[model samples]
Target chain A: MNSRLKFLLLNLFLLCSLSAMAQEKINIGEKQAISSAILNEKREIWIHLPKTYNDSSISPAKYPVIYLLDGEINFEYYTGMSDFLARPPYADMPECIVVGIKNTERTRDLTPTKSQKKSPVNPNVILFGDSGESENFVRFIQEELKPFISKNYRTQDYSILVGHSFGGLFAVNVLLTHPEYFNAYVANDPSLWWDNKVLISKTKSYLEKNKTFPAHKFLYVSQANNEEQNKNWNSEMTQAIEEFKGIVEKNGSLNYKHHFFESEVHGTVSYPGNYDALKFIFKGFRTDIKKLSKNPQLLEEEYKRFSEKAGSNFTPSETYLNVVLKFMKSNDFKESEDYFINLKNSLYPKIK
Target chain B: MNSRLKFLLLNLFLLCSLSAMAQEKINIGEKQAISSAILNEKREIWIHLPKTYNDSSISPAKYPVIYLLDGEINFEYYTGMSDFLARPPYADMPECIVVGIKNTERTRDLTPTKSQKKSPVNPNVILFGDSGESENFVRFIQEELKPFISKNYRTQDYSILVGHSFGGLFAVNVLLTHPEYFNAYVANDPSLWWDNKVLISKTKSYLEKNKTFPAHKFLYVSQANNEEQNKNWNSEMTQAIEEFKGIVEKNGSLNYKHHFFESEVHGTVSYPGNYDALKFIFKGFRTDIKKLSKNPQLLEEEYKRFSEKAGSNFTPSETYLNVVLKFMKSNDFKESEDYFINLKNSLYPKIK
Candidate 1:
């Protein structure tokens, strides 16, 4: 090769290598697929394991799973939020595995009844044309998706279902149909106006028949500002949600909390609403670090109480115990340090 | 080869390929590096571009930048949060490019004064031994980092600075030292007790000399529940922050908001605090989409008012205008649709 050509090639190689080094990708999760017989198709799933899931220093741990609907839109932020909220020494909730289920036919899967409506904007046009096969969709999740997750990951018995809009309607429907599927449900700006408030009737009938929600079941519903929504369409959305709220509150047997975000519209409520829902569902999970320094046994006592209220056992993870031990050692709390060390050893035994 | 051996090899090949297909990574951002003369070292940066940054359908756009501190910890959630908030039709803020600067020497870069203190837990050991080089650090951001971002990305003139704890102290210090660097500043549970309230002194002196903050400058400070903090250490944190709040509020010239989170502690306050800070800083950004359908001119009017308050020029993006156009067309608002088509064409003209 000519000397000039060799010099140019070397320069090109250096530039390419530099650019490659600068473009390291930041990955939050990975995709997986399941051949679901019920759905008669290959369903794709996005899974985000907690940071400690692969740490070799700690014992392998089981995390509660959150099955989130509308996966493509919400997965990235939801996973990051869960990890942030579950940071140890001041964790608001236990570390969780986030499973984001993407939609193929969103309207068909999320709606509960075969009903259609004329467009709010143009009366001649129909909305939700291929609507209402939630029973089959729920079956796909409960039978196929749940089994796939459990068989693959170290998951706790506790699980939560999270959805927005029609997904929110699905979450409410699943709670009514299969309360045993998940311990908690979050509905963000749900389309309760569906089929002229069929879910409202279902909620009332369920309460009348059962007399109470299943023990330890939690439901968090967030309603967005309806003033702007009223300008767009009829006030049916607000009316339906209010009616459902009144029925639930009057029965007073369910662990329910409803928040009305005055500033948030339908599209934006899920971000803040999801944050608030985690805080509410796991209200007693955070134990004071200062108190833990003086009285280390309080850690186990607090966890026990939280577990009792949660209706599921939630032991402090090996990662959290390690943080507690480090805090104690650095602060010169000898007794507390010894207590946590013993606790860690007992919970996560080393293999001989 | 024997039939059994051939079959085994074929099975192994299928399994490997299946696993590869299933493990496709979900990426939110990418990493970049800058060999900085100001810091005298190569600094790593995490950059997240908004979804529409690379869309070919619309004209290339410029985005406001958010310089985030303690980048390694907060980068993931902060990026996702920014993208979610900037979604069209109900966007609370403009699309922003998040640049997360990972820490090399956290205490040295974030603290302002060369002062040491005894450990709150153990009086024998001192804390922050290698601290106090924030002036040089801010210089790195202004001279080195900002220039790098502006040269590489399609960045708008507007920018924001966000920090937490010691990072928060850095933000406050930079605000007092170089208010023109960022259009807005956020400090979440800032360690105002640093160096015996040195930043507090700087704030008072700055106000005394200047008599008023630069026009359109904004500052948001969030205070976590000090009740638990009091149990851990001295009440100096709450006292210093309250004193600074009083000073700023009394001056009453800067656009300022202080929130006291009753339920949040030091470790967890940044999550909610950051969300609130964004909402406060971009208070007038969200326009009623329904109203825009009736009065198309209101769109530009809203952006004009918001831009004035933000001290920067911010026109509606091509992508958002497209969303508005679609909303109008589907709603049969022919006049409004035509108006938005003209707006989009003018703002993002096509080259023949």
Candidate 2:
């Protein structure tokens, strides 16, 4: 209660405060805006850099980036899913930078092939609006936005495009047209029925024309039970999605997957579907028990390739390596033992 | 450049800087350490508040809380996953708060009963150690920790307990012994084989004794294929999990789900399993397409109960109401229309 004791307590409080400040919150991500000439405006983007980014103590790393559409609302989903998928225990997907592109003009930017025909049923005023202009949006992303991100952040060339609904349509269109832009595309319940099913029809014809897709380009399409889940569901959208899935299934050259999520409805499918999409796209990246646990010695060679593919100086995280070590012996996994020993020496070399 | 131009540019830059300051980085959560008397140690805990936590202008809301084990690494996953699950387009769950409990002594706290026999095999010193003080740990949580959170934050009565591995064992132990603390229990790949399958045997006996549980409590158990995935995997752990699943299946009184995650292995099931666990526990919290899209009039009464269940003053979010309005005519959904009109007036009163 005295002034000296109070001063000591205050100093102790300040010290505790300073130490805990770093751990205050998980620094999930940052937001910034890009001045875009293509869109003739400034665009907002959310960036979640991986744990490996900007820490000088750890080895230098470049992470794959996901350029996600509907960034304002959906960015957190990608950030959450990506962070969970890439972290300890699962680590199924590589750690990556997630860039969420917030929408300024949803209909104008996301719509690829704008419809000229009027709605047969007098659409709601909010539902019907500006037609196309997605090309300029794509240009804004490719020319202005992507360049800006790469210049400012730690990123890799193995990029991905993620979108939902109309944004999903944008991702699909880009995969078919600008194939080189992203390595993988995830379209969750895409609006294939847009413009009187023009996208679906165009995609079918496009697949027929192009026999071979570039290698390693993966596309995952997720569909919900629209008709079954929603009574007022757009009939055309439902039917068109079925046809599009059928078309993609028939295309042998394309490395694509069309998944029917029967449990989810039109709106609620994004969360679980996108989570699955990430796992599907990045298959064979993690140390699966089925594949590698049988042959414990092969872990060394497999990890080398994993490191190469992840494009980062990858090592089995301490938690993962410990799990293996708990069950397996060093004599059985000679190569792994040596790798860890050398890594240990490099980290904490004995005094000369 | 002229002096006037330079001055204009500088002022513009200042304005932009000020505007962007608010959106600099997403404030994910905060951290604090609990001084525990039972454990005779200080334990770290992380807290993630919802979007509507402290904003005086929006609405006063109380959020459900999830107390997660192994808070150090998994905090990011919970923070990311919770933020996504409670946000737009897929707000299947309510905007709940998350509290992650970090460990000072893992084995000492997470195990239920001390093992009389040594580990089946000579366990890796780095991977194994002393255990069997979960009772004291649980006491610390129920006594010291819970009170601190309730005192510090706006929390609801509904709460969830989540854990993985040995942490999962602790979750099961607490659920069986102290069922009154949490509304939901999620054990992701619980270490049922601990202390020579003592926890599993105890659970079977516990189930036999308790014929009826408190109505509102829910438990979700996830299992992974250890033996099938790993050829050299421990048979004891695998068989123990099967028996545990069998026990849960035969018991009819307990409202529980025992899911076998065949696709995932021992280490990787936590990510997807925890995600599924959240969905399972909060069953029927979200608006369904089939239920509402037809009668849209039913949205009001349904949301009232949902709000009560979620323990928040929950109304239809703006985006959700707007989506409903897009397809249905104003006359079609009178109840929903009236609700929105009053909500709109309350939100923006100067319409005249």
Candidate 3:
């Protein structure tokens, strides 16, 4: 065939080869509505686990949990982030179970106190309808939800509470009122403007009294650019946030972090904010294999430091050690060889 | 009750309230194996779609797709990022269908050419067993997978090819060999050092000929800090990447972007790399309601620019329109009233 004819024929073949069809559904996490005696309602929740969650051969261990409020809306995003961070390469976050609590009453459950100001959108209607149920909501999680999780899920003592907007307010409320419940709290763009900044003022007094915590706590607060949208209105909001930050900063017991994202609006802040929150909480999570391989002494120190922060003791799991070993063996590092030998001996002291 | 007794009683009540149960499984996306004629084998695939993918009620439209290489390992991470980016609050990314191509032969499929060097980790073992099959693999995707996906899924013309490490190398190869395949290509820490940087040298020649593309393609290249471990080894990788960047920079046909993640090593680059890639490709994705409300004209111009770039003559979809209208109605923007009417009129045309 001629070159032009050959080109035309190839194009015809390509077009004939490819055609379109119907699409299949991509399923995500499972949802369940567990009856909550405390809230006197059936609370819906979405649960997502790591691939190795049930693989006994891969990971035979308990994992930490991240309990996200507004499960129906926010569960996928948070759980997805956790699932991503937990895996190889990044390994910035450990594999864990995610429990997303779907809201029964958005205003009622998430809000700490009833608002005197009318709804921002509606003039006559209260901002929070049948509100200030957060105390009960926290109780439900503490008494009903948590116990159920412990029994059902492979949960460790370490727990994280993640919330946004009204949910963020609830998270902070839990942190102040019942700090013992979770090891870490992530509050993104919290509605501190609720009831004329009462929550912010309340935080200072709470901080004064609560100087000691049963366990160390990581509190991440992310501020959105609400000021740009509603400048005069958001003055109160900004003030409340600043005051809360000041109080938290002064409070030595709390491992507090505040990030102000001018570029990200109220809604958009959650993605990067939540990501940073997790990264902050799990600081030093990604093992420095190059550093460790160079100086074996650093591994123990690194692990020790991570244990103190991660809540879980820093002993490398068998699977984790194997991954490290593979990398080390690939390069042939002497210090790591000795380190792995010691680890193997300690784990299998019964042998030989 | 006495203060001490009251505290004790409260603690006891809290402790008694919560208890444990049997763990439930966390449901994620399903997996399947499709027979490929090109490879003469059934290739495993994992598919995850956006929430609105099936729910026509909320979003009566098709979505763009992300075709991920090394699907079994990287699917969760990529899908997770997309899921996070798609939803409210962080609606930074549009809803996307994720089609993860699970590897039957990682080295064989990913590498375009055979390596002279043996496996760095296992010297006796060849680096790539039955390698140099990327051309066949691409054909499998073009003739088999693409057609299968088109037949099965509600996919838009806007497709993204996401790959990491050796998979990343495959992505760029596809871009060079068949630029008609995808709208965007994300190559994260591409193993450009493959077969002594022959791929990098090949790119210049391909760029020299391919001055025009079927669709304006977005090509995002990310570099990991390989220098953190082996300076000399990383030097070659960096050189190949730099050469590719230099060539692409000179070539105007490719919408090029390069990001160097100093902190993230070879393995961890995929997380932030993929995230940034999506963000870069979908530049100005988040419709600035604040800007739109002020000057409704900007919305048209903004979307027009995007439409031109995205290969979709992107009229704001009905679902996107509704989201904007809801926010506008909530705030009661006067300028937005006309915009809403225009949108509603254009979409419904028959509404009373």
Candidate 4:
């Protein structure tokens, strides 16, 4: 072939290869049907796995699961976070399965109580009347979805329930009603004023009645200025929740943590909150420092072991070590310093 | 038709309508081509406009332009940052046109010189010997790209050139050779060790000869512990650059800033570095506490003006305002607190 023809053909091949590589589909979850009796509908669900899950040789190990609500909006964030966090150095957090529950009827599936409130745009079609589906939603998670996940994937008993807004309301509902359903709960600015603060009142009642419940972690967060207006729904609801949190700390059984982000709004707080929450929750679950430090070879051995077991060509990158060191420093987990130093040494011995 | 059939038809219609709405694309930018003799190639450029471009009512306003390299990796970050930084309390930075130059053969286009070393796998294929393309790259930016951008976009003469890695090398190259090309240069962890420290030696020689150059802002950043070999490269290059910076500072012609981030790695430093670089470059640009405090109405006027002119329907969301406040506090630019308060009052009158 002539030079011009060869160049054209080469360019076409390069373009095709690059496009194919760039357009590689992000692994979205498998489709599953979840039915809710309260909403009286079946919704599709998507569950994402960590990059290390394809190994068939390793024995099926149970993994922690995060149940995410508003899967459409937050699934990508969770996927990115989970993938990054599970990689070396940030491996303080274990690799877990992410179950993203897609919203079929958002208002109906997420709301905790029924209210006769028609949206302004479509007054004829009921917009905000359906509520109290959270109970059934939690049940669907505990009874239907959890069972399926346990049977299908290598899932541990430990699970985290995550939600925002109405989904946040559902997360709180699950925490109060079925504490045993999840090991941890992350509720980001939940709409607590729904049905005239019905959930808030129920929370007070639940805390009053139940004492010495199961050991678990609960994170409740709100925006900075969300508490300014007394009449405002978010304002009033957040105040009531804060008051309830105070009561729970003083005399209740559940272990609870609350963070108020002055900089973030309801919508934008999820990313930072989720990142902080995961770090906080898994602060204790890490490799022993002594084991890592005493024998520096242990760090390399562990990395190699996991790499071999997972069949991943994963060597800890410098980015990984930095993340691990930062996590260690931020958490005041000094015991892990030796492990981190050893990790750095092992990863970048040529630097010195 | 039966009730079931009618319901199904209605559902289908609604689904189609929702799909159409979701598929509606936001017109973000105009695609154009720029001719370059240095590279002997034509490069496709994506020029994004401020929302007011189509509106005839807006005046012939000139805006500062940010020339972003590795545009594909960071287009969304720039877009979001530009949109947020230009609004409300943090209006210190002017609304500018963003010119994203897409990559074509990144290694070839960005590298400074051509190397002759052969690869271990293939003797015919050279690995790191590519050098000397940097002059041509700068010429493309100086002669062709900048003029095209100025002619097309409503841009001010003041420009900021930004890049990472090899792109960063080109940015520094332009700043060194033709200091008049851009008002500010941001080199985020540039490959200063390219072609066995060719740029470093060139910079040293250039600084020794030229006592007084044009007044310009140069920001050089180095990531901590990015790679095993990069650690040495970053430190050695930084030391050499620091020596050069000391000379320039003594001469009092060039305003240079250097930041060493021991925490962040190469891949992740872009987010925080970009944030800091923008703040540093635009420090004391247009901020007046006395003026703002005296005329509270001015804040509202500015807010209204941007809101109307930008076509963004931006009314200073609580989240946006919070970001402004956070940025102001961090930067010690708290002069516009009253102005921000007034803007907040105008936006949400009922809250007060």
Q: Largest TM-score belongs to which candidate?
A: 1
Q: Over the stretch B1-78, how does candidate 4's per-residue lDDT look in tens digits?
A: 556555655655565564454333233455566777778788867676654455454334567788888875555456
How close is chain B to the truth by TM-score, in each candidate?
A: 0.93, 0.79, 0.85, 0.69
- DockQ: which is higher, 3 or 4? 3
- Give per-residue CA lDDT, model 4, range A92-211, as digits (tens): 567779888888667777777777554322355454755556667766777788888888887766788888778777887777777767777887777776777777678768766765
DockQ of each: 0.44, 0.33, 0.16, 0.05
Clashing pairs in 1: none
Residue-level lDDT tens digits of model 1 in B1-352 = 5565455556555655654553498878888889989889999999999999999988999999999998889998998898898888788999999999999999999999998998877889998899999999999999999999999999999999999999889999999999999999999989999998999999989988999989999999999986655644438888888999999999999999999999888888899899999999999998877888878999999899999899899999988888898889888899999999999888888999
TM-score of each: 0.94, 0.83, 0.84, 0.53
lDDT of each: 0.90, 0.72, 0.75, 0.62
**Over the stretch A284-352, how does candidate 2's per-residue lDDT look in tens digits?**
667653334355546556667855543334555444554455434533555545555555455435566
Model 3: per-residue Cα lDDT at residue A45: 82
Model 3, B1-352: lDDT tens digits are 4565555455444433421121233434667678987899999788886776766454357778889887866776577668767764236767888899988888888889977566544477554656778999989988998878878888877788989888888999998888888889999988888888878778877755665544578889999887543444566677788888887787766788999987777877887788889888988777766566767777678778888887775556555667777777777786686788787667656534
Kindly list the per-residue Cα lDDT of model 2 for residues B109-158, writing each as its tens digit.
Answer: 99987754443233432334567889999999899999999998887777
Q: Which stretches of candidate 4 lie over 4 Å from their true place?
A: A1-39, A52-64, A89-97, A115-127, A148-158, A193-213, A216-231, A244-257, A284-352, B1-352
Collision count of model 3: 17
